[model samples]
Target: MTLHATAVPFKDGASTLFPGGLPARGGVGLKPEHFREIIESKPDIGFFEVHAENYMVDGGPFHHYLGRIRADYPLSIHGVGLSIGGESALDRQHLDRLAALIARYRPQSFSEHLAWSSHGDLFLNDLLPAPYNARTLDLVCGHIDQTQEHLRCRMLLENPATYVEFAASTMAETDFMAEVLRRTGCGLLLDVNNVYVSCINRGRDPNAWLDACFASIPLSSIAEIHLAGFAQDYDSSGASLLIDSHGSPVARAVWELYRRAIGRTGPLATLLERDNDIPPFQALLAEVSMAEKIMYADAPRALSGEVCA
Candidate 1:
């Protein structure tokens, strides 16, 4: 079982990496561009999330600065190369590297994407989508089970922002995900922007999709939330195709979706992801402030009239 302080508690005995689990407040992606500023300023954000693949190294400035920040704030290690939706088995070597990093950093939370990025040893450098059918469902569950058991910790699976859908799909994304969580006991990293992007691309109603997904899954199954900006574009047919490119400010629609998501799930670890066209550190922090404000609102006030500290 996990322990809780004023913040959520870390896994039973992971007192060293994080004294407590990441606070259910706004956090920013730990970018190399902001490392110095972050370490020097020690901003008031709840935590920081790092791409686990980038830190599978021996030692360097990355580790140096991350070590310093880890001492002062909560950390979340998010992985992009797990390919949990692939047909092939999980990569043993890659899993070992991830295990080593978790043992070293002891991040408060760990997560990966639901999409696959590899096939038969040829690793694709992108997060590709998969069909939502019985076969793929079983494959994903097995992978999640293997990952959680091998790491000896629970992991959160993120939803993918797909540009297309498979006619062969037999299940809705929400149902497939809920079943996986039930079977493997893993958690969810709900990405509100992805939901909006996918819904827009597929000509589906974003609000309806959100309602379906949230209704299907247990609220407690959500371990974290992600907000990011997407690049707007058009496909061959001139239909709007929003790419999940984390290069701009969070869209107004996504922010509204996030408001509703938090209303349903309550406070959870929220992250702002900006992977390209990186900007000044404070700019991202400003966005973090917006998210923190939303979280603070609708949040129950204390008996003395002060908000829960």
Candidate 2:
């Protein structure tokens, strides 16, 4: 299940992508709109996250700016194209391209969604939910194991923001993730925003999900936390679902949930994800500054040797 070919110690501060360490603070998703602004302004943020797929294609303005920005900031390559939970095997060509990029970029960290993006070779840009059955779990494990081997880096699997639950699901989402990490020794990229969004959409309790994540999953395996916004969708039956489109800023409630999660995993690398309706880099960095304030807010209280009330 070891994905890394090089002898990378799983010890603290191992990956250069994570070199400055998991920020008790966070940064915004690196968008093209903000590229020049980010470089010129040089905002004081922990790091920047980029979709590996966006940069996968060659000879474009994206890489041109990405390279320059990367020189100044630690980068996280978060991918949604791997389709880890799909019925078929991992896309070998995609993995090869992804691995090549990872090698060239030397990213601080690499992550992918636990949900599937492809089914039987048909690629879907959206993260499709998988039924939590043994077959799906096995597929995820095998793919994750193979990805780690192919990329020669320990990958962090992210929780998906799901809308509908499959009737065939036999296990809780947290249990499925625990099994995958247990089988593969890969890390978890907990998405608090996705948890809130999914809970709202699926009628599941967000607190319960967090408890399951904290208790059943390996805290040591937690490499990062993600925060993003969701849009609501209504079904024919009048039921509503919150979709993780990442088109807006993190909600206030989601930020509160983030506080609780950080309480569990102190200073985990957190990112403010905005995939659509991209904004100016400085504006996004302002949000990052807000997160930084919240993340370190309790430090002064804790350092006084007083229990955080």
Candidate 3:
């Protein structure tokens, strides 16, 4: 089932239209609530990323407005249902639909999680963690190979925030992800909030984790950055737990971490993700503005290491 990497040229007019990829500025998650406003006002932003599963179906208003938005701004397709790490083979049907979507939109970039969301034909509807071991690594790499071959585009794999760690795991998360990137020729979509969440939940320092990641996977391999908010909760042992709820504005601490990340990655296409407790589009733009300011303004490299209030 291996497909060799060969160029699948973009549709004739697509190349002339979208001559460049997403800018290294900031963007927000594209929601139905903001479609009309976006179509009418045409907000100034770097790009827009949409969940591929949301637009998998054949047409209606979603495609109509998305087509208009796609024309004006670069689009990034982020998938939540690929189940790349699952033990089962990559779902051929889902891959076909994803490939069709890519052909239709010609997004500037595409990405999926490092975790699995399906077992058998049943989808769990959540991105669940996988062990950082030899077997899981092989499975994930194979899936990425399938996805890239079918879609004819490089895809970024995002790190996951987990509530529990697998005792059977034999490698650090960063090292595992680095290996995956090496084997698949894919890129990383460094999610600073996920770093903060996984570290805080597992009793580790977020800054140290970020540094470790940079040491293993060169910043150049990171194609995009994701900044989001988390909900705070507690475990039975009263240990602090952070949930990747994406239900609020990016936290102050996560913002500091993002500054550090971009200092190394240097203005990659950054996305602000808010899936629940969705606020007004204007409020989301304010956060995007903050990200743009950090990305575009000249700053010292040392500033990245320092997390200021």
Give the best candidate by TM-score. Answer: 1
Clashing residue pairs, backbone N/CA/C < 3 A, model 3: none
lDDT of 2: 0.80
What is the TM-score of each predicted model, taking all chains together? Answer: 0.92, 0.89, 0.91
Candidate 3 lDDT, tens digit per residue, 111-180? 9999999999899999999889999999998999888878766778999999899988999998899888
Q: Which prediction has more favorable TM-score, 2 or 3?
A: 3
Regions more than 4 Å wrong, model 1: 1-11, 14-20, 301-309
Query: Any runs in candidate 2 off by more than 4 Å, and if so which?
Result: 1-22, 299-309
Error of 1 at 279 (Å): 0.5
Tens digits of lDDT, candidate 1, 78-150 = 9999999998889999999988888888898889999999999898979999999999999998998888777
User: Candidate 1 vs candidate 2: which has greater lDDT?
Assistant: 1
Model 3 score (lDDT): 0.86
Candidate number that wins on lDDT, 2 or 3? 3
**Tens digits of lDDT, candidate 2, 85-180:** 888778899999998888778887889988887878688788888899898888888888888878777888999888889999999998888888
Q: Against the correct fold, how does model 3 do in TM-score?
A: 0.91
